[model samples]
Target: MVKDECKTLLDALNKVSACYRHLVICVGGTSDSQNLREELKKTRQKAQVLASANKNKLTTILKDKTISKDDRAEFERLWVLFSTCMEILEIDMRRALDLGQEFPLNVPTKHLIQTGMIGRTSAVAARAISVQNMKYEEGNDIDTIDLNELEQDISEVGEMIFEMEMKVNVLQWTVEAKQEPGTELKSTVSAGASSLGMISVHGDGNKKLCDTNKVFAGAMFSAVLIFAIVLAVCIVKFA
Candidate 1:
């Protein structure tokens, strides 16, 4: 909800500013700039109001004596994140206005990429993964980093991996369903070593290469998918 307030307000201002820029420069006129300026002012006011409400909510969450330690920690973390984002948004707004910089229509990441308080993908920055100074760690007396979400994610993934491996083994066994219980799944081994099989397979080197390529591709895909999912969870949790 806090992220929505910050991002939606910034996005509105950005879009309107971009349109105003295009109209005044690309279309060679300032006809739309006046209305866009008014809209920007209104959006700024709305954003400020929402920001105040967000802070009040955070303050209430923090001061509630009945709240558990865990919940309080979460709320405190949220306050830090929200405050950092607002700080960046305000500073960036000032910078833009001072320089008369035209904002692009494309919305920035909801995770507040500008403040560098949250990690981001390689596409947005030079690093593949940038560790954020979460919970106002850079300025706070306490710097205890929380890894609970990461651990929970790993546990869930471990369960999924076990299930997937069991399914694979089941598939291997099902392939020989009609064979005797003690029979080995050696059909391919026997076939490849037989004289008839040798004759048919002697000239099919490309097929083996293609099969190897597919296995390599599948492994790469699985590795990337796991990495991406884990990275996303980290971003979401710390944001």
Candidate 2:
């Protein structure tokens, strides 16, 4: 029963990963903006459901003393992948929803003037600036953009080419870790071998010292016996 549960979790994770990949491709601009938004919404809902359901399983698997070390490690890895995918998906969703809104068909001359004065930036940044300018022009204080959102827009073009860079970095790191699996384990094994080698060297030195002492003692005993025999012969001759 436990094995089945674990396998089901793995399968679900794989499906989520695939969904993330598909979303990434869609957000790459191959799909129309409307279609992209739809895809993002669908994928986000799927991920949310997966997270809600499996989070407990993830915790349980990690905490269960009965599970093997390998199983726990596998679950831990999947959890990381799941979390990362969810984050990038969220960023994409927010970018699409906020930045993808259609501007008013009629552009105000005052807003255009303000946007023109702003320095060059990414399309998303320019759009955000233009939208803010429009809002300010219309005295729409209630809809004024947040400073942090403006800053994020300036720093990232989440709607276009820049969308994949963060995800790529994340996935690249994960792949590298997987490729070089057990680096710490290798170091630990090396340390254990070195410790055993040191003990073996010390044992050999002690054995050699014991052998040398035994040889010396035997020589001393032989000399004492010979001297005693010679002294007895001399005593008899003198008598």
lDDT by residue for model 1 over 63-156, one digit each (tens)? 5689776565555545545544455445434543532233322223342223322222212211211224111223322111112322333344
Q: Any runs in candidate 2 off by more than 4 Å, and if so which? A: 1-36, 102-239
Residue-level lDDT of model 2, residues 168-218, one tens digit each, is: 223324332444667769979899999999999999999999999999999
**TM-score attained by model 1:** 0.32
Q: Please, what is the whole-model Cα lDDT of each candidate in the order they appear?
A: 0.42, 0.49
Residue 136 lDDT (model 2): 20
